[model samples]
Target chain A: MTRFRLGIEYDGGPFVGWQRQENGPSIQQCLEEAVAATVQEETHVYGAGRTDAGVHAIGQVAHVDILKEIAPARLMAALNFHLKPNPIAVTDCAVAADDFHARFSATGRAYLYRIANRRAPPVLERGHVWWVPAELDAAAMHEAAQRLVGRHDFSTFRAALCQAQSPVKSLDRLDVNRVGEEIQVIAEARSFLHHQVRNMVGTLRLAGEGKWSADDVTAALAARDRAAGGPTAPPDGLYLTRVVY
Target chain B: MTRFRLGIEYDGGPFVGWQRQENGPSIQQCLEEAVAATVQEETHVYGAGRTDAGVHAIGQVAHVDILKEIAPARLMAALNFHLKPNPIAVTDCAVAADDFHARFSATGRAYLYRIANRRAPPVLERGHVWWVPAELDAAAMHEAAQRLVGRHDFSTFRAALCQAQSPVKSLDRLDVNRVGEEIQVIAEARSFLHHQVRNMVGTLRLAGEGKWSADDVTAALAARDRAAGGPTAPPDGLYLTRVVY
Candidate 1:
């Protein structure tokens, strides 16, 4: 059996999420089905990130073991052909080491949150961006975001359903910048607690609106309670941009 | 009646075209309906350009006459509320002079055509871009695009049913640039014939593929026949970006 690593790009607006579920389709089930169709064998695909519903991914990584004797390019082409009508594309494929694990082997992961900071609602970028009607101060958001960097118990930012055993994770980078009418919040770390990025963005938006200061963000982090944090930003604007190994 | 000029943005995927038709919905019909619902009067909306089906717009200009006394921002907000679920937005609105016609008063227009030049298909931007699976030489395309930058008889690029009285239109700019994995073609002109930009892009793609050169493009332009030019590019990649008054 050969283990192949796949680079995936998907619009999560349609799927239930990354993991398999009985209520509706998920990215993992669709990918596994595509692989089964290509290799004519039941196989499991392990993903690097378990993105939530309505969350997109541009650089999602996955690994699958198959018994088919096909070229990586051929397998990728075939899988894409089968993944048709579903907004998912297998961009890259290569033979991976037998010990390679898509989740456990990943050393770093990055996320990008996009907010359309304008009075006019987004038409073309409707589902891909969070439309905040208020004019946001991106510089202030950046300044306040610096306070969240480093290791801390991110209980205020953690999701209730998060499976991570520890809430303390080291955040390597958290930067905010405005590109035209869109405000981009980029976060990088070895890993993240569930809903950490969205929770952080929601809290930073208060700072962008001049409603909260850097010291308030520091206090929220110190509180270590979800109630003290801001609301969770919608999953529509979140994108799993990269998973570094 | 007060004449109001509107700056509009829309995803043209669901519409028949900019003009009203019996077959299906149109952008003009939707905007007119929204205006009627807002002011309780039937009115006409004149657009700066008649964009084809599947073409998008970020800066499309239009005008409407209404009897209601309403602020521009309030009108814009009400129209947006009424245009719900449709991928259309009235970005800006302002009172206009009696003689300011949306179609006649426009001085210049700009269009952007995006091509995803990559092996993988676009997932997030599926309908918003044209996917070209081959590597394009953007510099070569840019070099050849310069040949079409002057006033010329463009019958070679004109559509058969184009209603323009003459095929002579001066093109101010035709530029090709590579942005990441996407090839962007920007065209600016006072006006364009039916499918002029798409035809030019189709021919330029040949140059990008190393199959044609600048001289070949000049020959095609000089032929004065649509059959001499390459096929028309898909409307999916075309976007009406700006309108200068």
Candidate 2:
């Protein structure tokens, strides 16, 4: 028996999210079914992050133990073949050590949010970006984002059903930049509270629109209340870019 | 009646090319139906470029004459509102002179081909990129692509069913460059023969793999025979990026 690590990529448009749910289809459910079909054994796969609905993942990591002695490469190919008709693909696979855990062994996580800051709605990038029809000041958004860096109480950005033990978390990086008509926000940290990145983006958007200033962002963080923050950004733009071990 | 120009963008995965056909839905058909639904009149939409199946368009131009006196913004909004449940979107709209024709008045065309030069099959980019598993040298492809630039008898790269009067055409530009894991081939011309860009891409892929040389490309163009070229690339990676008039 061997624990195998799989590097997964998927379009979240069709799935409920990364974790399994009784309400709808999930990425985990698809992968588990694919694994069962491949090895003829029921198995549970552990993922690095439990993303929300409509959120995508590029370098999502998962691990599953198999009773059949199969090569990781063969297992990956088999899983991809069975995972057909779905938009998911297993990009890479490797045999993992018994101690390695997809969720616990991870040291850092990185996310990217894409906002189509343009007058016209997104056409080519539909379902892949948050279409913000108003003009945004990317430079101002970047400046305001700096105030949210470092360890602080992020209750203003946390989700209502967050299962995290504490609201305090250290943000290693938070950058806002413009690439043509798209405004991109990149965030990296050891972990994040549910909807933390999206909530921060929603608040930062007000600064981008000339509604709020950097000082206002500082005030929101100091309040440490969910009501103090701006509206939560939609999941259409959130992408789990990477998970570092 | 007023002639209006529309800038369109669509994911071609769900269309049978850009022209209206009885086989299935097309981008042109979608626009015409939307126009009928909006202006309360049946109208014919003329397109600047007729893209193929599975080919995307980021900046496709089209024109239609409307009997209703609707503002350009209002007409655009109305058409977009009716184009729902489809991947097609009207990005921009403008009032054009009655003499202007989307097909005939167009003086320049630009196309972009995307090749995912990676080992893994696309996940998020599924149906959006041509995944090339083999290693490709973009610089070598660029070098060979230059040989096919300028005016030439491009019958070697023409399709079997092309309706152009002559195969001789001028290529304004052809560039190959790698952006991280993706290699992009950009082509510009007053107009192109059917399958010209895809044929050039297929031939360039051979050069990228060290199968063909720059001299071979020059020789192929001089042959003026469709069988002399390498092969036609799949439409998945091809995109009609711009139509300049």
Candidate 3:
């Protein structure tokens, strides 16, 4: 048996999420079916993260073990051929040791949130960007984002239905900047509870709109209650850019 | 009657072209209908340039004469409301002189061409960019592009069916630069022959791939024959970025 690690990219607009669900299609199910069709066996692929619905990915990581021996390039090509008509793509693939796990072996993950801070609605970038007709103070957002760039009990940002045992996680980086007409927020962490990055971005948006200051963000983090945090940002703008191992 | 000039933006994937074609829908037809619906009259709008099918626009200029007296903002909003569900928007609007015309009075125009130079296909920007799998030397492309800038008989790059009276138009600027994984080409001129931008871009692709040299480009321009140049690029990557009057 051979194990291969694959780098994946997806539009994420059609699927329910990364994980397999009974309700609708998923990136995981599509890959697993493709693997099964390629090797003529029941197979499944493991993903590094279970992204939410409407969340895009550029460098999502996954791993699959196959009974048949095949070159990494040939396997990737075959899998891509079977994933045809679907927006999912295997961008890169490599041989991996049997001990390598896409999820457990990961050391960090990164995400990017795109906000079109302009009056005009995005015609070409409708599904890819969050259109905020109001002007956004990206500099203010960047200043407030620095307050959340450290280890903390992120109970205030965690989703109510999060299954994680602990609310504590170390945020490695949080950056906000304006690129052209869009505001991009980049977040990096060892591991994150459900909805952590979205909640933080939503809180930072308050600062960008001149409604809150950096001190308010600090207070929300210290509160350690979900109610203290702002609303969750939409998933259309979120992209799982990379997974580190 | 008051004449108003409007700045328009659109994704040209659905239209046959900027002109009102009998085969399929056009941006001009859409705007005219929206105007008629807004003012309850048979209104027509004239455009600064007639873009080809599948070509996008960001600052396309147009002029319309309305019989009713209405504020610019209110008319813009009303037209936009009537233009619902279409991937089109009126970016700006202002009063214009009675003698002003959209096409005749235009002093300059600018276009942007996008090339996704990578292996993976673009999922989000499929129709908006030309995906070139091979490696592109943007610096070489830029170097060769300088040869085509200035007044000359651009017959080599003009479309065979171009309706222009003369091909001796001055190209003010042509620049090529790489932004991340994409290569951008910006072209500016007072006027252009049909398919001039696309043909030049197609020729530049050869320079990017080391297939053609700067001297070869100059020779093609000096030839002053349509067959002397390379193929016409797909309209997918070309965008009417700005129109100066």
- Which candidate gets the maximum DockQ versus the true structure? 1
lDDT (Cα, tens digit) per residue for candidate 2, span B213-240: 9899889989999888988888989999
- Indicate the worst ten consecutive residues by lDDT in candidate 1 chain B: B118-127
Better of 1 and 3 by lDDT: 1
Highest lDDT, which number? 1
Residue pairs that clash (backbone atoms under 3 angstroms), model 1: none
Off by over 4 Å in 2: none
DockQ (C-alpha based) per candidate is 0.84, 0.62, 0.55
lDDT on C-alpha atoms for all candidate structures: 0.96, 0.93, 0.92
> Clashing residue pairs, candidate 2?
none
DockQ of 1: 0.84
Q: Return the candidate ranking by lDDT, descending.
A: 1, 2, 3
> Ten consecutive residues with minimal summed lDDT in candidate 3 chain B?
B118-127
TM-score-sorted candidate list, best first: 1, 2, 3
Query: Over the full model, what C-alpha lDDT does candidate 1 score relative to the true structure?
Result: 0.96
